[model samples]
Target: MSQTNDYPLSAVPQSARKGFWSTAFVLLGFTFFTSTMWAGGTLGTSFSFGELLWIILIGNLLLGSYAAGLAYVAYKTGLNSVLLGRYCFGEQGSKLADFVLGFTQIGWYAWGTATIAIILVKLLELPEAYTTPLMIVFGFGFCITAFIGYQALALLSKISVPAMLAFIGISIYQGSIDIGGLAQLSNISPTDSMPFAAAITMVFGTFVSGGTQATNWSRFAKSGRIAVVTTLLAFFIGNGLMVFVGAFGAMIYQQADIVDVLVAQGFILIAVLMLFANIWTTQDNTIYNFAAAGCNLLRTDKRRTITVVGAAIGTVLAVFGMYNMLIPFLILLGTFIPPIGAIIMADFWFKHRSNPPSLDKIKLPAFDACGLSAYAVGSAAAYFSPWIAPLVGIVVSASVYALLLYIRSAQPVAKPSAS
Candidate 1:
């Protein structure tokens, strides 16, 4: 199939829609991310096991709901985030959304690329000299499925999700035994304390960028309801598993990452397999996200070409140490990315009435002041807010966009200056 068959520049046709399991597995694989485990590890250190569960449940619920809202819009219109941006952000202004969203995905791609390479060397006791070569190999290799597009992603996810779950279940079972079971695990105390708000922000921030771009696949859902359910399945349940695994490891073994915990538990072989499956699933999705955004940014249908280019860019970043910058990158994502989804949702519900016009059927403005303005305000609010920044960004931006729409509608026409 052609790159255009991926529909980089247009809405997907009804004939192209996928079934529930296909959509669900694709999204679930994307959510089975290692960085989320790291985020959970951070939370594990700061909260009791009971408090961690509460935080994970609440945070993933918020994340799932936010993704599901966008998924419904995507399913209705068959347009991803960048295409939706054109309606609210206008033709030219949408490029801002493209760059911001695209950059974050690449950052994540780079970090994941760097992480697996580093972890492999450490775990296998390979020479330090192997790190760069492994990074080079894995960085491009992981995008192979993504370069093949949605069908390949679904197949890989269908296999990897179950396998990863099994690996996690074994690790958790072993961890429980080593730590003297769940009762003792729960009674274990936190080594540190953090505000609940900050914890929520970390949990939400960890995947908000991916959730925003998930529309790239959600747009292919058979129906809006399917999109919503699939999105929630991935972001809520799948992502929640990542958080739980990380926190569980930290609480029992004083290791926040599942791979490290696995090695600590003498599961070296399983650790290698888990790392490959975990990183590959997310890496393909991440690079695919960059390609989608890149396509819209460049106004081209060359998604395959863009995929290669993105992998190269990410590989370079990974080689130069993208892994070390993860926390700050995630914070930046949480602060700025949610507003893009917020504006798109507001435009869909308020301006489009949940039924946006076809991209081919209309000529969009060069810029929509309402979207650009609201995004700025929302990002600024999120940056400064003492509350959970991502949630704050979404609420503030959507409210501003709705208010702007209302104000615009209520205004009287000037009647061509009484000509």
Candidate 2:
């Protein structure tokens, strides 16, 4: 296949790549920090102080391991994370993976767009009609940013990432001193208490696919070490910072909305910058993935089709006020995301024995009955299991796919006779 327009499909060589620390910084910037804090603050306000900490610690540990494992798999496999699902899912079965991933990207983009719109409206005291158009414009801008692809994204991240970190640091310093000491922080809680499991699920759900994205980004890294180190460092620093801020914010505001609390604390500038960076990086990465998946599905150039389609979808959703409802959207995302990760890991690590044919070399297979059945069973397991849906789904799907593949291979087939 010809290279897609403006998309960085080729891998970067180790000799030509930047140092690990620099790469780590870029990854941290790309991941950004505020979203986690925002999500955590939301969760913390709804849960007990001790419960919130347990969720963050446990959730990040699982998500971090999953992200690392998936990244390693993608590095060794040299395939797009979603494309790796083809081994188990078959060529057609992979489309289900694409749909789940693509829609989740769209949902996140819409949510971020709506969030920016609401913030701008509140900050400037703008009229509803004016703010609505602004939302569409901003949403379209996000699509365009992703259309420019990796280089532009890196540049944007470099600029916004530091600003976001500084803002968070300042906020933490202010909150710590103002809200008494660390011990007093736990005393503050939200009006509506959230369960610990639910909180952990929300945090894990946000980053479960994050590792999958790391694989895409890691393709750009110079070496496997660079890929591994950069990803881990980024998650620890960027994501860790967010969690800290979230915990602090929860202690201070006793509310779920971090932006509101930031404003109240007279850190409005920092709040705005953090919000913009969080949404911008997230939307850019998501649009790129959406476009890549769309291109793969259509057998076309991703850049040309993805930019046009993503922008239209993002704009329409923003105009319709679709993104504001985030909690429900996240809950829905939790349902299907685990299976995708499971299928990818199963295909790369077991089905292919860590080696799959090159993208150009392999011919697409017909829908695999075993893969689909596994997915069906896995989804049901996730829905029914109360603890760690992603973990449960992975075990259920991987075992089923492996067992069925074994059975299929063991059965003898008749040989065709030469005329």
Candidate 3:
């Protein structure tokens, strides 16, 4: 399944597999922003400083574990998440997962593009007429980066990651001074409070779906160990830093956005740099995933066309202000996505324990009744369960899938004997 030099298919081929650093950099760029800080801002407003630390740690640990396992399989299989879903959900049926993963990414892309567009307008004091074209420009610009494929995304990330960090460092230092230093802020207790369970859900819900789609980039890993270790490292450190920046900014300046904090502190140039770099890093990856998922749905390798179409669709949605009103959709995405990954892991462990067959080699069913049923059951539990909905979805789906597989395996094989 070799793809052209110009286009890597939705299901990436082995030839395009990247080294650990490249994979890590891209994953880090993907996991590094947009929601972590927002969730941290929410947490800071609700919980005490000590409580926030524990929640961030525990929540991210769960996320890291989830990503580590999925990343390894992606590295070994050389398939994106939607392609992996086909083995469990059926080639025709996987469009559901593709729709969910792809749709959500497009939503995020629109929101990010719109957000930056609005911010740029404010920064430059441009007329309102500029918003729509700005959305179109940024939308198409980001899409082009993704259309160029993983190599370009990784190269941009190499620069964006460090630039983002340098500014975050400066923000932390200035924010600390404003709050009378780290010792003072650390000692102050929170005025508002959130339930522990709700806080944990908030953390996971922020990126659980994106984390599940990690194979979109991580499949490029040179080895399973590199994939697992680097993926976990990115989730823990890259995402955790996002949370810390938000919490620090919120507590000190009553602001969640570091860019806002920089502007208030009169570092307008630095503020502009941070704002562009942060959103661009993630938005391009979002478009990349959109193209991958589109390729899966259309069963084609024309990634560039899909990228352009996705960017256009997202830009239109942003213009209409539709992307921001999709909190419920995002929540649904969190609940449903984890089970897909869980089923993939269970199928690999139970059915292909000794040797997992490649897509071309395996005799696959049209759809696995057990896998599809298990996913539905998991989604129901996630919606109804009081706590840790994503976790419940994973555990229930995996357990049900594994049990079905075990039952099938238990049927005795016929033996021929001499009488």
Order the candidate numbers by TM-score, best to worst: 1, 3, 2
Q: Candidate 2 residues 98-201, lDDT tens each?
A: 77777777766666777788777887678877777877778888766677666676778778777776776676677777877667767765666766666767
How far residue 6's Cα lies from its native spot in candidate 2, in Å, is 6.2
Pitting candidate 1 against candidate 2, the one with the higher lDDT is 1
Candidate 3, residues 139-180, lDDT tens digits: the string is 888776787777788898899988888998888888778888
Clashing pairs in 2: 46-194
Estimate, for each residue in 1-419, the C-alpha lDDT of model 1 and write its tens digit: 35434999898889899999999999999999899998888888889888998999999999999999999999999999998999999999999999999999999999999999999999888999999999999989999999999989999999999999999999988988987878886788899898998888888988999999999999999998899999999999999889889888888878878989989999988888889999999999999999999999999988999999999999999999899997788788889999999999999999988877788888988999999999999999999999999999999999999999999999998776655
What does the lDDT come to for candidate 3? 0.80
Query: Which residue pairs collide in model 1, if any?
Result: none
Positional deviation of residue 357's Cα in model 3 after best superposition, in angstroms: 1.1
TM-score of 2: 0.90
Question: Which residue segments of model 2 deviate by more than 4 Å?
Answer: 1-26, 33-35, 189-191, 255-258, 417-419
Worst 10 residues of 1 by lDDT: 1-10
Task: Please name the candidate that would achieve the greatest lDDT relative to the true structure.
Answer: 1
